[model samples]
Target chain A: MSGLLDVEGLVTRFYTEEGVVKAVDGNSFRLEEDEALGVVGESGSGKTVTALSIMRLIEAPGRIEAGRILFRGEDLLKKSEREMRRIRGKDLSMVFQDSLSSLNPTLTVGAQIARVLKHHTRLSRRARWRRAVELLAAVGIPEPAKRASHYPHQLSGGMRQRALIAMAISCNPKLLILDEPTTALDVTIEAQIFELIGELKEEFGMGVFLITHDLSVVASFCSRVIIMYAGKIVEEAGVHELYAHPLHPYTRGLLRSIPPLEGGEARLQSIPGEVPDLINLPPGCNFSPRCALADERCWQVEPELSGITPGHRAACWRAERPAMAGGGHD
Target chain B: MIVFLSKRLLLAIPTLLVASFLIFSLVHIAPGDPIQVMLGDFQDPELIARLRHEMGLDLPLLQQYFHWLGNIVRGDLGISITVQRGASVTDLILQRFAVTVELAFFSLIIALLIAIPTGIISALRQNKLSDHLSRIIALLGVSIPNFFLGILLILFVGVYLRKPWGAGGYVPLSRGLLKNLAHMFLPAVALGTAYAAIIMRMMRSAMLDAMSQDFVRTARAMGIAPADIVRRDIVKNALIPVVTVIGNSIGYLLGGSIVTETVFRLPGMGNLVIMGVFRRDFPVIQAVVLIIVVVRIAVNLIVDLTYGFLDPRIRYGGER
Candidate 1:
């Protein structure tokens, strides 16, 4: 079956005065319906840019140079802005990271939710408000009626996030793109938010495009994962497969960086060196500067994402070597 | 809210007292003598002394201040010294204040009507030709003096066009609303243009800030119509800061109306105060200045209250 979202050879760039920043260089991924697919990367790794490209929300200074985002087998790029407007909140919705800033300060949380319903649904004003309050309650907010009248600042961080989620899911979108949705929340709230999203995915049967820097978050919440580096995907595999046998050296570094649950003398390992500047990236693989296993060939030529074990892929020339198959963990 | 309001009102008392004291002392210290101006070329020392005694100007400065303060507290603004001898300063102010209030009110309306839409458009289409045009217009509005603009308006609309309502004059509201508006419109435009420029630039920057905020992105991502996003997300949030600018500018508007009123030949507080200053009408000057200070205080209070209304995070006196 065709996937719910298929991004093909996407290249998004920002034309700044400095240079053209290849924010999301040529990369592609697919997300199945009702499946949770996580995009893992450190900051400036083009994960957010990929999601924005799909949403077609890239503004001036940034342009989707070349891409085909197929949603439900229809080319979204081919759709008119007016048609895209109808499809956006109804068929696709996005929840941003900063809940407080993501919600309008001047409007009550419910009124903001009702606004989405106002455009997407034919519900009456009163009915939209009622539905908004209902959505709030469904998102686990207490005293839905009273909370509906409260502005975003009046609510706690978790509650505000819940309000944002309620707004995103108000129209019952088929695909929900959550960009670092729990990054601003505490650990406990983060777990609860993911749990809520998991439940909502099942309830709504919505495919989730979960983007985060945290490997553990994807490990817990996503069934399939794609690890991105700089502006390209470095690895793609099933959650268990990726965790047990991460093919890419960058992915291995990420997996090793996750602190073990049982506290021991093992210090958390960090991937050394910063994300490369997109405007002036080094020759060969973007990760070569930081990869310990990077050889002469790795510095001279970039590698394409090639299948290793069936269903597992990595864009590393060294991944095919038998000695590296064990997936280093110390 | 009530507690906050009452506290602010109580604070105004001390402020008004200080302002009144300053006005009284300054007027008394100034070289011009109302009696001398009133009895021009007469050279009657005995009459001047008797008149000064009757007016209680011969009393000690502190005594005079206390006496005037006492009368002010009792809602008595005293009699005009020379501008209109024996006429109640309170009555004179009341008559002239009506005209100024109308002028200021209409000017504000004109200002908002011009500033808001243009501000939104300018911000929405930033760096575009329309935006550039609006910015140029706003710059002109700011750069050109109101009196000079007033003269240009008179030259264009009054002399060149030869329209009956184009010339400088005041029409009482009692005559008719349209006639009153027509007479007030040009002066209002003259006074308002500068404020419009100020408010427009404020609104433009504020809108730009609002547009770049995360909430606006969320609104757009939700597929809310572009118009709706602009209205609800951008404009609504943008108005908060712009309201503050508008509130602060109201004081400027009232002050600016002085020149605007003079140019337009309107019998407003500006004209009254000018006459008072020239004649050294102490009571008239003191009362008019006092009223202005009070009006400014009241406007500031209103602005503060509006903050709570605009942004829900602002709760007066910590009330939920």
Candidate 2:
């Protein structure tokens, strides 16, 4: 089925003093309606950059070099900034990582949310304010009316995250892109925030694109998972299928790294080597330097994301070799 | 809020007392005897001694300081030692105080009007032609002295262009607001350029800093218009630090107005202080300096209070 949002061959780059860093190198993915697509990657894997590129929020020194972000069959890249602005926060909204800093400290939380409503909807000032308080209450913030008048600093970390979620869902957006939303919160608060987001998504019938590095967060929360290495997506599969029959070496390494509950003294496995420098990426497969399965073919020629099985795609050259693929450990 | 304000006001008492004591002792220690200055070129030892004795200057310095302090505490600023024999220093200062206040007020207005927009433009157009041009202009503005700028303005506008309003002069606002403003315009510009330059650089940097904040990105992502984001988010956040700079500059403006007034020949506190210094009018000198100290302190207090208004995080005493 055609997806609710489709990102095709997206390439985002940063022109720094050193060199042009290919932050996101021709990566493609999709999110179906009412589905949560987890983008799992290391810090510089262009996960956040991809999300920002989709949002059209990349600032100076960075530019989206090439991409077609099709939201509801409309090419967002072809839209003007004014048009994009109208699309943003109305059609699609984002929840940023650092909730406290992400919020405007000078403005009250209600006012910040109300401002977005004021821009998109034809609600009067008082109605928008009432809607803001309702959104806050819906996010499970106690004393919503009182809290609405409070500045970001006055609230606890969890409350601020809730406030941020309230703002993101203020317009009942069609798609919500969450960029490491729980990275700064404690584990319990993180879980609560995710639960809140999940509830909001259900209530609003919104598609979610969850960008995170936490495997467990993805394993439990996402329906489909995309594993990225460097600036490219290496694997895409149903979350359960990917976990049960992992194809990509990087994805296997990621699953192995998750510490088992009720364990038998099993050592947590970690991938060797670091993410390659984007400005000076090695030829062929970007993950070759870190992959144990790398052969001359893997080094000499980059593998395209070919379907290993129905609904499962991987870019690794050894994907078809079941002997080397399933939980391949040294 | 009341507690915070009361605390600040109570704190000012000790500050003012210490400042008054310092001024009293410093004036006493200053060279040039008031008696000698008063009877310039008419040297008579017996007459000088009698004059010193009558003025109570013959007492020990500490005693003289306490005497002045006591009088000041009792709302008596004493009399001018040199000017008009026994003219009340309070009345003399009151007569000229309005001019300095008017000049300072206009200079601040000019500074804010010039700096705020230029700073915003320079920051928004950073690394572009407009940014570089404003930086160069700010540099020139900061380098040139107020007096030099006043002289240049006079030379160009008054002497060369022969504009009636360009020359150094003072017209009381009571005479006519527009005419008075016209007369003070050049002086304000002269006095304000450096201050404007200072505040502009501050605003530019502050705006640059504020623009990088996550909230600004959030604002943009929220689909608020770019202009609205700059106005509602960037400018408000940026103004927090810029407000401090602006407030501090008012103190600078007060001091700077001294040279500006002397150059422009306005009958302001700066002019009075200059004359008091030259003629060694001890009471007038002492009182003016003390008043300036009080004004500076009050300005700082106002700045501190304004911090709360600008930043919700910095509420006075407790949360609202």
Candidate 3:
């Protein structure tokens, strides 16, 4: 009853040409009903895979190696693809990043929305059509009925995103997976998207597994946050707790990377180097090669995720006494 | 779309011109004189030389090409070197063209009908028993030469089935439609096999790729059924690529079906060209080659237009 979604030790990999990419290593988290949890990381930090894995949308060459995706205490991984399809768009749904490409270009938005209502709910044609318009309006699409008749290509990017949001929230699923849902928009449009997600969450009581590479979005919108690096969770804590006392160096690096508005200039620090390639990953801590405090222990054996606070976890040898950062330590 | 097409067309012009020149020059280049070949070796040398000179073989190669090009621009293809009742090359072209067109057209229909569904099913259940079996079938279709397949089909359907089912021979669609299909089946299968493999492989891969796209995943996530996913989402997205392969294969269908046509004793352009080549009927060969070239060019133009229709993103005017 307490946790609406409990994911533990989720592991995913892909047999790619380069090698077997350990895209998502062991990671665990929980969300209360209607709670918004943010997953933050740079590109290739297992952020998208974790979101896709949650949606059960990981394609061939990539699969759920081992994991327990418990949705309201039921193991989702064990469900048949058929049963999973039933839950998708009803019990759980995902809002993908490429909003324009994510929509079927040939299908009218109304028909697309009507399909879910038809499949998941026993609504009459007229009633479902009415509900589609309402959902479109709820997502702030102007001229709901008129715009609904248009194909995805006819709508602007922002409108297409809203359509996707409308579709995701159509069934009022228990969990909504948003994988950089606002990444494709401009800053001005980005604000509108965040506001939409916020409004939709309040209107419909549902868990939101919001995946994004932008730390600022997580800082502003997420109740709890998980910071990942090199396919594994490096840090997890309540948003305020992590912001007040960031434990992992990678977390500290990421927070420092974000420039503070109305204040610091050279304070923002870009973490040196990219996310380590998952294929042929280094021994010990995957982040050790990039870590400033890499030592014999950090380089010899991997640090297990250990509790730094009641619920906050950090996988670092120096988790207890990590250096504090200047407001914008660029 | 226009930019891609203009570039392709600009390239095609040189190609057609070259093909036309080659066909014309082929008559002159052959060891025997064209007039002698037409009038036979018994004709006097002076009359043979006079006929060749009149036919313009005595002109320079470049002059011959320019004269041919000029005539082509005026909608004229010179008289046939050997033919009945003094029919112009163009007239003979029109007369024989229908039979070839009908054969190629029927073969193309057979190819699409067999290939598309097989490809879809193969992709939908990839690596399963049916899929593996389909792969085997498609492989056999690919490996066995089309002419040989055509001969077998004639034996089985035309000879064997005809004995049991009644005497078999082609009835044009304009004739009794049902009987026409029955008569055409052997030739169609023979001509269609090569293209069938190509279409099947392209469709299967394209369908597989389309099924993996986010839009299709979104479609399924929206609770659309699997069959509908294939029809609406997967196959639709897969078409642009599939169309390209199919368009290219049509050339093989029309021009390359020569062996199949010969085996089935069908009167297609392939058979015409083969006969013309052997008998040294210079004008017939030239006319047939030119017509095939033009048909290929026209088919390509249609394919280009089709792209714009299928995807609005494709602009036929220019890159802009």
lDDT of 3 by residue, B139-211 (tens): 8988888877876766776577764222323456677777666666677777787778888888899888987
Clashing pairs in 1: none
The lDDT for every candidate, in the order shown, is 0.93, 0.91, 0.82
Q: In order, what are the TM-scores of chain A for the candidates? A: 0.97, 0.96, 0.95
- Model 3 RMSD in Å is 4.4
Using lDDT as the yardstick, the better of models 2 and 3 is 2
DockQ of 2: 0.77
**Each candidate's DockQ score against the native complex?**
0.83, 0.77, 0.34
- Provide the lowest-lDDT 10-residue window in model 2 chain B: B77-86
Please give me the DockQ of candidate 1 compared with the native complex. Answer: 0.83
**Which candidate has the highest DockQ of all?**
1
Flag regions of model 3 displaced more than 4 Å.
A13-22, A65-67, A123-134, A143-146, A149-154, A262-267, A272-289, A293-307, A321-330, B1-33, B53-78, B88-91, B155-175, B315-320
Candidate 2 colliding pairs: none
> On residues A176-219, what C-alpha lDDT tens digit does candidate 1 reach at each position?
99999998899999999999999999999999999999989998
Q: What is the lDDT of candidate 2?
A: 0.91
Evaluated on chain A only, model 1 obtains a TM-score of 0.97
Sort by lDDT, best first.
1, 2, 3
User: After aligning candidate 3 to the native by TM-score, how far in Å is the CA of A59 from where it should be?
Assistant: 3.8
